[model samples]
Target: MFTAESSFTGDFKLVPLKWAERARKSYPLESTSTAKAVNYGMYTPESMWNKCTYVISELLNECLVGSWVFAISPTAADLSTIASWISDILVDSASLVLVVLEWFQVLSAWEKTFGMPVLTRQDSEVTYSIVPAKCYWTVFAHAGASWQAKHVELVTQLREKVAIRKAAAANKQKRPEDDEDDDEVDARLHKARKRPQKNENKMQTILPTEKAKAAQQVEQPEEEEAVDICSDDSDDGYIYSDEDYSE
Candidate 1:
């Protein structure tokens, strides 16, 4: 978990506005005019917004140890926007800390109220701190025009990946309607096996015992059948007489 205070050093070395003003006065008028023209009077503000942005960005890039970064341009709207962006990043970082704190609080409350341990050991506690120097370096790297767009694209890719993962997890929890279709197919197969067939050949073949019993009960007289058989038989046990019977 990360906290705003822990993610950024509370002790930032900010140069006073008076010092910047004094420094600006020391520069030649021609240089001052050129800088002013190029930066839209970025150096004049009493809040030292441009100076803070430059310092913070440089520090973040140089240190490379923390998440704090001055992302806004020095020529941006005003001190308010810079302050707001910094505050927003701090709040975002702090929210992660708050979440972990809330989770622990909930666990503690559960343990006290229900008399059951929610966590096994206090040794598993996590600690957070800002790596001020590294954080400054990271911010400085993005100060370049090309790097800013790259950073935006990287952040977008990360967000998209997270969304895809969340969707996959949600899909894993859902039961699709195909299961019901499978059940219906099984029921139909069971019903088909139980139902009687309309075709005579199919029905007769299926019920062999009934067909055999019916055939046995239909008896023919042996004496009448024997006389017909004897009249039909010829010398060589042929049913029809031929012109030649040598054998």
Candidate 2:
């Protein structure tokens, strides 16, 4: 439902485009050179960027109102900048749960999204945690048996939501064949319909029951004509023939 023209409004469009254009300073896309040389041009990236925007917007729109997961696997030039643009667009949305994975390596602020710090170093090794929603983000951040148990439980619940979303998406993308196994379903239905049945006999009934047609053919009693018994010029008074009833 989210089209490029309708999804972004006022500042939503302006801010992201501004950020994407600004990121050209670091990322250096091909469009940047054209815009700089022309001195007046829109610094829009390739069409692929628009597709990415559409998908992200659609997922976030769903996530804002419904239970869904909006994931971003950033692998391109200026990823941090792209991350910031994503943050700006999602900043105003309520109930937004963001998860960041520093798969390549942790940037300066890779440990957080929306300023909720989630990365920590435990025993001189890297570790990650989920900062639950509360007045205090560090409610369950402490390293203790109780805190660990609670964090695990909360993360498990979040994963369950993601799983539900995945399952729903899978079902939404399924084809008719996925639900049907019979190859002769259409053939059987066609054969069933083609079979002669008694239902149609009422329309084409046999001759004996066709009373309306028979009644129209039955002759009616004809009124008699007055005889010319006193005719002056008659040989046998009048003449009647078989042709008289032919009319």
Candidate 3:
């Protein structure tokens, strides 16, 4: 997102060399031949400084927006404070919610991608909170709590197929007499998975159900083709974005 080239305009390729030459030319000659000349050059152009400041401000704004969204605790007081902060920022008063939401208009889009920004009503007081993007485990647990026996059984079956296979393979080289067929090993694994009584109530489903996957597909259809975000097509280690923000 950010690049070094964005800090300057025009032919800045020779700026460093030019600055060195200027420093040498401007240096005052000392009368004593043995005296060491230590010239500190502060020769940055005004345009370069302004460009750098703009880039820094933009980066800070993005960071503020991201951190505020992710790190804030889910609380009414915090929500109210942030809302007021946003209001102040919109009026050019700057209360640290650094995003220019008017420019990108991606706040609501992000909410859709993550989850609903939850609102709670307690008596006469109404409070709002943003659910974190990576709360899938919490969401699934809440959903799976009221699941029917059929759904629970289905999820359990679909959940740990890979783990089961891995355990089977690992145990295959154990003792000659202990060696067992895949079916036997699988059955053993299923029995072993059920042995942990503490998590019996908790749904063990990490992956989504087939029906849910299908529903998601229907809701958000895939693009015709994948679009690469990198500016350059080369497979070199360096990545370049289109939003270089050059002056």
Tens-place lDDT per residue, model 3, 1-247, is 2344333211111113344364312212121110221111111111111001111222232222222222222232332223211100110111111112111112333356657553222353423232211122223333432322333343344335645877899876667556556669989889888878536444445334666888888999677986777657768867765566452
* TM-score attained by model 2: 0.28
Best by TM-score: 2
All candidates' lDDT scores? 0.34, 0.34, 0.31
Which lDDT tens digits does candidate 1 get at residues 1-247?
1323322322123324574365422222223212223232312222112112111232222212222333332333442211111211111111110000100112444466878645422255532211111122234333544542444354456556767988999887736687788789999998887665546667677799887777877874445434553375456666643434434
Tens-digit lDDT track of model 2 for 1-247: 3334433221122123454364412222232222222211222233111101212242224112122222222222232312211211111122222221212222456344476433333244422211122112235323344643454465456557777988998888858785474556877887888666655665567654677667766866667999774555757666655576476
Q: What is the lDDT of residue 102 in candidate 1?
A: 7
Per-candidate count of clashing residue pairs (backbone under 3 Å):
16, 0, 0
| Candidates 1 and 2 compared by TM-score, better number | 2
Order of candidate numbers by lDDT, starting with the best: 2, 1, 3
Distance from true location, Cα of 122 in model 1, Å: 39
On TM-score, the stronger of 1 and 3 is 1
TM-score for each predicted model, relative to the true structure: 0.27, 0.28, 0.15
State in Å the error of residue 69, model 1: 18
